[model samples]
Target: MPVRALGYKPVYDYRVDQLGDQGGAQGSILVAGTWYCPSMPEPLIEATSDLHAGRIDRETWVAHIAARKPYRLMPKESKDAEGHQRMMCPAEAGKVQCPLKPRSLGRGVHLPLVDPQPSPTRPLKVCRQRAITLAPEEGAEYWQALDYGDEQWQKIYFRPRNSVEGHANRRKITAWLDSLARGGQRPVRRTNRRRKTKPLGTWTPTGHLTPAT
Candidate 1:
């Protein structure tokens, strides 16, 4: 939380708890860390749960996620000096479609139009507004600068994590060698010694290996 106050948005994999089975906010559902329309297909809400429960196969769960698109961030003007920014629901942004948002039907030409079955008797705030303003203080606590678990998040999180760890590992190795040197011990360099396999052959009584004719 302190780091967030200093303007750092943490990127992390969704723990089992973060995947919501239902809408976490008045008119929005939380998936990974982002807010989505409450009408996000039920299977998607249940995808992570089903996967962990073994009720669905990895392939099926993967397909579910593969079909999922990322949320679109609104314009720069949506935010002031503060960290708060206006974000459009996935459906409204045209990443996906919902009958609730009539314009969405025309939008998301290449995206899936989900039938929001058993439509909410009373539409939530998000379905009606199409966009929501989130602040760093509260609702956006788990919020990701990049859509969580999407290709962008992977690109943003993985490359840096790997490269940073590589630097740390190298530093540790160097420090260890320095410690060894200070103690008058030579650091042993490791070498790869591959055992060469013999070609197809027969062992003769004279302890000779004869290759096949």
Candidate 2:
């Protein structure tokens, strides 16, 4: 039977140690993390409701549900007014046809089959023109050499000869800006050595610090 995901749900409640033999430790279940559990049939309804309400994430919910044993609905022999047996599983009622074929075997049967021809394999061709190498801009090497102090600036400036280079460059620039915004460098402080002094009746300059009376 096909199981459709109606929504999210809580699938397990016990510690990892309870799972046993599989080698897991007991701990509180994280909503979005992976979990292992033994299969159960009833609590799945409440778990699914919790998941849809944002109380749990899909990972833990799925793990809890998967740990439970699968339920199989067998078709009943009783037929309705239309002479059709009602579907045992409501989810599959409208879509799937019930198994109605009788179990039997006849005396003689004839069978004929032919072998299929194998498909032809073709050799893969490589184009030298398509395999172009990437090179840095003329001034890029100079700027990288001065800024990074490395001759390997070619590796940093050059990129794969493809459409993704622009996107990659944007990502690199964004990362650099984020790092700068974090204030990773320390600020430099300036020190003063000047001193102030006072004369007999008025203020005066002793060394660098002098006041006019």
Candidate 3:
């Protein structure tokens, strides 16, 4: 496959160290066509529900995060200690109360917005133009950029290109998107689990059979 768009099914990466089936880690290629990180949702549901139900305040929630194993608020110099960049971690995190600041919470910690800002700049290697639902009337400026100089095109889309075969790849992707838009085919969400039911009994010479028999 030449870096085509992802289907809507989730992909599971199995791990042995973690207990439970599939190691409880799963990821999905979302409708926007981005690969989401694999995560275990089991531990989060209760805490999330409590937070949303207003049973716990933000301060309490922050404390809960620190309480989790392997996520200590200990000093960076401590053995196996890890923390957000430039944030201070107390030498005796458990013994003393650690002060909470906006910067202390690292990435992926969602908070209610008091002031909204534009999204942070993507890493140089990441694509600025994401997979999106195509519009039939999208202009030539958009399509032409897909065939730009190799370096510029790679930066924009975050993919490698060939001098001879690059145009063909762009055309293929463009045509695929166009067909989807023209046909009004929306992306459908899919789950990884297959349905299971008891097998129907088979007839036998001895007698009518139940599934157990």
Best by TM-score: 1
Residue lDDT tens for model 3, 15-132: 2232121211011111111111112123322333445568787666554433332221222232122211121122122222212223323333342111112347531111121112
Ranking by TM-score: 1, 2, 3
| 2 or 3, greater by lDDT | 2
Q: lDDT by residue for model 1 over 1-213, one digit each (tens)?
A: 578768677887767776754236656666666666665676876777788889899788777765555433243335657767676777766677677778778763677776654654867666667577766564555666666555677788899989999999998888667555445667665455686875434335454655456
Candidate 2 Cα errors over 4 Å, as ranges: 1-42, 64-69, 76-83, 86-213
lDDT, candidate 2, 1-213, per-residue tens: 011122222222233332212221121111112211112133442454556567778776665454321221223345343333322321122211212211111211321111112236421111101111112221111111111112232234343433477888898777666545245564333345465764454534467556553
Q: After superposition, how far is residue 85 of candidate 3 from its true place, in Å?
A: 25
**In lDDT terms, how accurate is model 3?**
0.29
Global Cα RMSD, each model: 18.1, 29.2, 21.7
TM-score of every model? 0.61, 0.18, 0.16
Q: What is the lDDT of residue 33 in candidate 3?
A: 17
